[model samples]
Target: MRVLAAMSGGVDSAVAAARAVEAGHDVVGVHLALSRAGGTLRAGSRGCCTIEDALDARRAADRLGIPFYVWDFSERFREDVIADFVAEYQAGRTPNPCMRCNEKIKFAALLERALELGFDAVCTGHYALLVDGPDGRELHRASDAAKDQSYVLGVLTAEQLAHTYFPLGDTPSKALVRAEAAERGLTVAQKPDSHDICFIPDGDTRGWLADKVGAERGQILDRAGDVIGTHEGAHAFTVGQRRGLSIGTPAADGKPRFVLEVRPVSNTVVVGPKEALATAEISGIRATWTGAPPAAEEFDCHVQIRAHSDPVSARAQWRSGGVTVVPDAPFDGVAPGQTAVLYLGTRVLGQFTVDATVSAVAVDA
Candidate 1:
């Protein structure tokens, strides 16, 4: 089998590409240049896809003795990942840029190109397993729970899953991957893993959004719709945010308040008690399955809302335009635009983009 290994200039990807070579697959390495800012350097692993990262990827490809190339996907990335992120925030929804990148750039765009070039699969270092189930390929959690990335990858469709390869999914720990990289003489063995949004390397998300969306003075309101304070912009806040809210009026009970909602259309930020963040139900659109769609319209599964959040036992139903999930217990701080990944034990059933949430406390009342 011919494999296209995505070398990200990181230890995990370097090892993943090397493993693909060791497995006797005809492998070719490619580094994706997601940004045109070639002079930009990674800020101690806060961001990725910088020029230095591309160079590192080239070096790893050299060590592995594979044909290497850097593909310029900057325009596509800006349109799909970065632009979508800003637009989602501007519309008062918290979006995961990494999820968008995986869905739009890596799996969709890169896989399309790889297939056109006759590669059997596009391999990466993602910490998620691909298992051949009765129906077809199924996505599963990585063996290392701490490093499981299946939640972010839940957006993958059945077709995408069929052409994806993860070499590090079965690895026991990240330490072992680093050790393997050192043994393979990969220079990125001691490199720190990138975190936060890659485009905003400084880790100042609020500042970054403000620049993109253009912050304006907005009213901060309570559940009763009465103004409690003022904010620089609605885009700077998201549901369940606790700190940095400059509210002049304290709650009646004198407890701290949390951001319950961001209404971009109204240019208002709603603040309330923490309990208001407990969501009982979630409704999502843009559903995608890892393999076959569920056989039943209604079934039991585990729903995970965030990359690191624990999955909650839930009942899911396929509705007219989307899916609805009712967790056995309330999920704290679920927000619209978040991805809800359904699971049956370790197997990922599918994912949906959350469009609405019903508060558990409100429902109970």
Candidate 2:
């Protein structure tokens, strides 16, 4: 089998490529240039896809004695990930850029291109297991729970999972991968893991959104629709955000308030007690299955919202356009535009982009 190894200039991806080579898969390495700015440099592991990273990927591929190339997917990335990110924020939703990258750039575009080039699969360093279940291929949690990435990858469809490969899924720890890289003489063995939004490397998300979405003074309202304070912009706020709010009126009980909603259309930021952030039910659109569709319209499962959040037992039902998930216990601070990954034990059933959430705590008019 021919494999396309996505070398991201990190230890995990380097090791993943090396392992692919060692497996005798006729591997070819490719580095994706997501940014067109040639001078973009990584800021202390805050961002990725810089010129330095491309060079590092080249070096790693050379060490593995594989054919390497850098593909310029900056335009596609900007349209699919960056633009969508700003649009989601402007529409009062918190978007996970990494999820979009995996869905649109890596698994979708790259995988499509790899298959067109006659590669059997596109392998990466993602810490998620792909098991050959009785029915078909199933995506599962990685052995290292701390490094599991199946939550983000839940957006993958059955066909995408069929062509995807994760070499480090069963690895016991990231330390072992680093040690392997060191033994293999890879220079990125000690490199720090990238965090925060890659485009906004400085980690100043609020400032970045303010600039992109354009700051406008907006009213901050309480549950009863009474204006309690003012904000620079509604886009800068997200559900469950407690800090940085300039509320002029305090709650009657003197309890701190959290951002319950961001109304981008009205330019309003709604604040309420933290209890209001508890989500009882969540429903979403654009559902995609990891393998076969569930036999029943409703089934018991586990729902995970964030990348690192624990999966909570839930009941899911297939609706007309999407799915509705009712967690056994309410999830705190769940926001629209987040992806909800459903699981049956270790196997990922599917995922959907959250469009609506019902609060566990209802407010009195």
Candidate 3:
């Protein structure tokens, strides 16, 4: 089997490429350059697509004696992931750039190019499993639950899954991969994991957007619509954010208030008690399924709203191009533009972008 490994200059991907070689498959290493041009390394972190990372990937390929190359997809990445991220935020929604990268670049563009180049499959170091089910190829969470990345990959189509491989899915811990790299004398064995979003390395997403859109002064209002403070911009805030709000006045109950909503058009940040954050249902657009769409109109399943969050029990109902999910219990901080992944046991049922959620009803006296 011929495999094209997407090496991100990290220990996980390095080990993945090595595993492919050891499995007796012809392998080629490719590092995706997602940045426009060479930029200074962000403080305290070496993000992906850096010159150092490219060198590290080359060294790993040399150690494994495999063909290696760096593919510049910076333009496509900017259009699909980074630009989309900025646009969504400007519209007062939180977007997950990692998920966009996987859906657009890795699985769509890169996979298509790999097939055109005659590779049988494209491999990655994602901590998720691909298994052949009775229906077709199914994606599952990785062995390491804490590191499972299936949520971000929920947008993958069935065809993409058929030609993709996750070599590190069953690996119990990342520690094991580091140990293997040490044994193999790989250079990335001790490299710390990439932490910040590749494009926004300083972790100042607001700063990045402010530079792009120009900060606008806005009013910070309490739940009752009374102006409590002032903010630089509504885009700088997200639903349920508490810190950096600088609201001097306390809530009626003397508790710190949390941001409840960000209205872009109104340029307002609404604050309220934490209990106001609890929501019962969510609606989303752009829903996608792995295989055939479910036949049932509504069914019970587990739903995850954010990466690293435990799946919550919920009932899902599919609409025309969206889905409505009602969690068994109220969910807090269900933000718009976030992915809502549905799971049926270990398999990913489908996913959608959260548009809105149903407000909890008040009890009658």
Model 3 CA deviation exceeding 4 Å by range: 361-365
Q: After superposition, how far is residue 53 of candidate 2 from its true place, in Å?
A: 0.9
Give per-residue CA lDDT, model 1, range 1-365, as digits (tens). Answer: 99999988989899999999999999999999998876878778788898899999999999999999999999999999999999899888889888989999999999999999999999999999999988889899999999999999998999999999999999999999999999999999999999988888999999988888798998998888888899999998989999999887778899999998889999999888899999989998989888877889999999999999999999999865899999999999998889999999999998999999988776223
Task: Tell me which residue pairs clash in candidate 2.
Answer: none
> Where does candidate 1 clash, by residue pair?
none
Per-residue alpha-carbon lDDT of model 2 for 68-185, expressed as tens digits?
Answer: 9999999999999999999999888889999999999999999999999999999999999999889878899999999999998998988988998899999999999999999999
- Lowest summed lDDT over 10 consecutive residues: which window, candidate 1? 356-365
Using Cα atoms with residue i matched to residue i, what is each candidate's TM-score against the true structure?
0.98, 0.98, 0.97
Instruction: Report, for every candidate in turn, its global Cα lDDT versus the true structure.
Output: 0.92, 0.92, 0.88
